[model samples]
Target chain A: MTTSTRVSARRLTKRFGDFTAVDGIDFEVRAGEVFGFLGPNGAGKSSTMRMVGATSDRSGGELSVLGLDPSHHGTQIRSRLGVVPQEDNLDLELSVSDNLYVYGRYFGLPRRQLRGRIAELLEFAQLSERAADKVDNLSGGMKRRLTIARGLINEPELVLLDEPTTGLDPQARHLLWDRLYSLKQDGVTLVLTTHYMDEAEQLCDRLVVMDKGRIIAAGSPRELVDRYVTKEVVELRFPAGQARRAAPRTDGLARRVEVIADRLLLYTDDGDATAEHVASSTLQPVSTLVRRASLEDVFLSLTGRQLDD
Target chain B: MLPTPFRPLSYFWVSFRRTWMSTLSASFFTPLLYLASLGVGLGSLVGHGQRLASLGGEDYLSFVAPALFAGTAMQVAIGQATYEVWGACNPWSGAYRSMQASPISTGQIMAGHMAWIAARALLACALYLAVSAAFGAVKSPEAVAGLAVGPLTGLAFAAPLAAYSVRARHDQPFSLVFRLLMLPLFLFSGTFFPVSQLPVGLRYLAYALPLWHAVELSRSLYAGTFEPLAGSGHVVYLAAVAGAGLLVARRSYEARLSR
Candidate 1:
């Protein structure tokens, strides 16, 4: 009920016929923070985002966005909340500036104000030079940036981004992350969904891992990783078929040993000791690596499957 | 400031600004070409036949021009509504999906789409009327009323086609609608010949169509031969068809976009 809580959902549920897309989930996003929903495909992340965006109707439970119920106040809530869908829906026939202009008008913003706002947004998205260019002519990264810029046209207090940088290359993804960081600095509350573990670690201040329409874990990225996984991970990839056989030789040397495909991952506080211990054992591995544990490791530990799979 | 339902007009307005030159040329020349080829050229052959009396005792050129005006309105309106409405919901464009993210409701988006189609129909019909007038087809000042009749006929088709377009998963059905339904109505619905010339059952079928009512209403207006009862009947029929189609289209848009 407080003003600082931008979104609050208590046991929110969404069902499509016989299947439940978001099953009795609970989460809250505070103002001026980047919140994330991290899950693999079919994890119901986008479905939950749509419910919070006030576009899809919830079949059960209570939901409040910006202190308004979406069922009753969808138009009002949406007026103040910007949304960037998973797909870029820019008007490809219109100029970059006109796409922003037309979307601004949908909020009933005056034409005179929108003209200046469009210029500022285009500059913010780093697309000033392409103002008159058709959206069809822009590269994949440029189009994604333009979609983000268009969402900001209403000066919304809260923005919901669903998989913002799914298809972009590494360089473009970094540029987008910088823009998102700037938005956070401007005191805008952001709720985004991404299956990318690095993106969740780098951008999200707090996040929840969803799987099969339910939130299995929730916390800051570091907290989730620290609580669920060890401080360091030792990955041992044996020659093709020997990984499963070598798993027993590394028992009790670490907190946990997960045999994934051709690699045996040892979770331990001291990855170097674990790697050295494995080297001294009877097992002869093809490759060994020691690295800091990440959200991907945490997800794998929780779900028993890779995040990207 | 525009109302909530009309806010989407800004999108169409910007689009029209870019393509209006080509649209205008098409609108101006399409009627001109039809009138020149069918009305003037074909009229010369039909004028010497006994079919002249059945065309309400008017010249063949004048008789066919008014029907073409109403027919062109139907074509323009259907053309505007089909691909644009389909593309709005399709993945490539997703224009409706984008608008659904804003404050605009699905009903408002449908209203804006229908309004834009009506506007285009009005513009195209007005041009068709101008071409008919230039060829000495218009009989009286009352013929100006055909302008309203033209767009109404267009809406009669556009609204229902838009309803179908919103839910269409592919473009195959649209081609069927055009080839199977639209072409038959355009050719046989009393545009070029009198409905009385057809066999009894086929004549009744033509009379049941929206285009036939439009052609009849337009010819009456252009010839200054408006009948009190029949004129009211045609207007009511066309209005009802348009109003019913709009209702269905609004619901279809809501079902598709709000999901």
Candidate 2:
């Protein structure tokens, strides 16, 4: 592995009895980069994340985190890495600050150093005012923030977040993204798993799109969008049961036409031209919207299914 | 810095601060009330009877106190291990999962869990012994050995029960364990009476349990009748049970947490 590589995996596989959760996949996470695994649920994203975190054993393959083998040096690798699981898993019985304090202790962090660190983390998570409140009493957003803060208590070089914003509202997700962005600014490598395409576009400096236990595509979000999809997309909503029948009429107007439930997506270089073609054509739509291509479209185009589906 | 194996204790210590009042009160009052109602109230009727001979020629109150001490340790340990261990693995309160994500290994987590149970057992048993002393149920200074015996017996149950709890997906199994295994062991393990009073089959079964060995050891020590070989045998037996349980718990924690 290179010096800049924080995590490296080669032909890593994880199997549960008869089921293969993570097929052989190779990826590298560099330092100070926000790397992401973007996939729908059960895409083996979590299994891959757990292996990198050194909490799950790989059935077969070579894996290294922080330049050490996880199979033999899990504790050592984990000591220098932070993990925020998909579920908050905050100790509901303890206060917000106590959660951070106790988690730091698990890393054998000195109590004296942890006190200052806890205060700083609580502030960083915007939970300084609620330090003494029970975790059960905190809102969903506050709990997510505290979970992230707890993950940072050990001052790890790399932090692994599994579906960090899976259940948060828009405002909460934005706040969390800002915190994560600031972590990146401080040069902390972040590896996260999210089914949210926008979240990947917003946070990931580089990412891999996974499906069925394999990394199907890996690149910068803009690269993936530019390589796999058009520059713009036109979304047309037709009358009930009309989207599929209307799909063929707009065939030549766009480079690609996809008929999804109740809507027809026209992928083209100019969404306005596609919309104009559709407006003058025999097909009549209830509504039409033109927008820039995004990771969502890239995922749809690659997998023939929505990212959140 | 604390050693790696004991790191997870900090979590229990922090959480204990919030519920220590109720926990300590229950620990203190449960034995006190049991001693008052059963030992004192019933001892008045049974103390002067020929049945005292079967109880080693001791007052009924003194006879039952040490057994209660050991029994209470088992109760407290199982009580702490069952729900907490289950909750630690459960989705809503994934405390063990949270710890597993850190540098701590599942082995360390298991060790820390048993250590916390031992600590709580020591505290609870100490209070029980003090109450026994106050009630004049403590017959000799050797009775202080109950402290060691208490936590040992507690661990014998806690470690294995924790292993079982780690695999339990729901709370229903816990209540079933309480109703079937724990309750039966608590009642028939010589806590309330001597194994000699039981039938031949039941008596041998009581002798096979960890709590009975603890009760017999505690009773002999409290009555100033401890035999070196017998006491050593009981100690070794309880330790073996606890050691085996810890082994199983470590494996279970590793298997479950690593997933």
Candidate 3:
């Protein structure tokens, strides 16, 4: 990924009358990088994506896409940007190939060129065999792939995906991740939002963690983990009734200790040392396991709440 | 360069190509059948005489052709204007939403939709005129002028409905348009019979509606009895309605989509 910026926003915000959806936030995305917005639902990730896509005007802020102001040059900016909204909006009246062909025409692409491109894209999406099939007949994963393929029809320079894999099975999510990896290898800038921590860790070169319309943290996923949490964590689960009472006994053994429902999480620099400390203590009577820190750990420490909750 | 607002017409044409068969059957054949059953089957009883004298002393079929032309245009235009616009805005297909992400702006999408509606009205009117001619409904060569009037009537309905449909979150209101608005216009406008036979109040009301003006304009053109000042009045009315519809629809589309 090049260091040159493709999208820049300063104090960008969006408000729906009485409610603020995207609070004032600042960030920049570089060309050819897999940038991500990591957030839970209602975190304003989709609202921000809409602004960068040039489909939704920013309520207040200075925002530039492809170096052009969205209010003045929205049409021009959108011409080169492909967007996959959180939901699949494929035309149900058209076939698989027609969906791509119809969307390509919106870019003012010539019919002759679109025919060839549709063929190539169908193959790229692994949907060549379903080109003539009606879009209604396609499975959920197939529809998602077609939506992504439709986004690529114009050969856009930057692609925005909002919650690209929200409701997909693990297998389908991985397949989409593979296609996205291939796109990144081709030097196309990628921006996406996801609630899945693993998706952010696996695909994002740089990302921002958003919560409640605000950017709580911004950095590479690894960097955020390193900054907000320790290197390792030990999971010590006790019987339900005894877990809350067992929390204070492991306090001085680690940098921090978190008591969730029935388990105590010990955060430290060394998992083996923490696990040993937990074993010798009278804190745990059920099970103990140690693992490396993750984005989930970082988020839990930052918000005092679980990522998926 | 083609105006930026009309650029989405290309997208409309591509999608229209796939559904032309069903679209043609609805917009063209349905009107053709109406002309046959109502104008011919019913007109046979009201054959050329004083019984038909109130119909401008012409055969029932010939007198009704222009009104049907206007009515058909309205039908075809409003058909695309409603559910199709709703479909584009709906989260399901989001055709307009998808286009909004491209180089096309909201005005362009509205222009393209209206253009497609006009295209359908053109085809439907031309085919209906031809069917009427086959049944000896054409009184003069000037009947072709109704081809132009067809889209104007269609736009008179389409432009307003298109604007309203963009803001519609559900389709229940669209069906109400047909039942409440369209049905009344078809029956009260000078489509089935001359407005001269109506009560004085309803006659003025008929004159106030756009379709009545369309029916009069198309009929005068087909009969070669064009009155310069009167004809200009009809033309001006339809144009004003269409122009106003375009202006309002443009603003509506711009406001709805930009958000």
Interface RMSD of each: 1.1, 1.1, 2.3
Model 2, span B74-93: residue lDDT tens: 98899888998888787666
* lDDT per residue (tens digit) for residues A1-309 in model 3: 124889999999999998999999999999999999988888899999999998889999889888889989988999889899898888877789988977887787877898999999999899999999989899888899999999998899999999998899999999999999999999999999999999999999999998889999999988998899999998888887778888778768999988888888889999998788777877745988888888888778888887678
Colliding residue pairs in candidate 2: none
Candidate number that wins on TM-score, 1 or 3: 1
List where candidate 3 sits over 4 angstroms from the true fold.
Answer: A1-3, A237-246, A261-263, A285-287, B1-6, B47-51
CAPRI class of candidate 1:
medium
Query: Per-residue lDDT tens digits of candidate 1, residues A1-309?
Result: 688999999999999899998999999999999999999999999999999999999999999999999999999999999899999998888889989989999999998999999999989999999999999999999999999999999999999999999999999999999999999999999999999999999999999999999999999999999999999999998887888988888878899999998999999999999888888988788889999999999999999999889
- TM-scores for all candidates? 0.98, 0.98, 0.94
| Number of the top DockQ candidate | 2
DockQ (C-alpha based) per candidate is: 0.77, 0.81, 0.57
Expressed as tens digits, the lDDT of each residue in A1-309 for candidate 2 is 899999999999999999999999999999999999999999999999999999999999899899999999999888888899998888887888888888998888898999999999989999999998988899999999999998988889999999999889999999999999999999999999999989999999999999999999999999999999999999999888989988777868899987789999999999898889888988889999999999989889988999888
The window of 10 residues in a row where model 2 chain A has the poorest summed lDDT is: A244-253
* Overall local distance difference test of candidate 2: 0.90
- Candidate 1 interface CA RMSD, Å: 1.1
The reply for model 1, stretches above 4 Å from the true place, is: B49-51
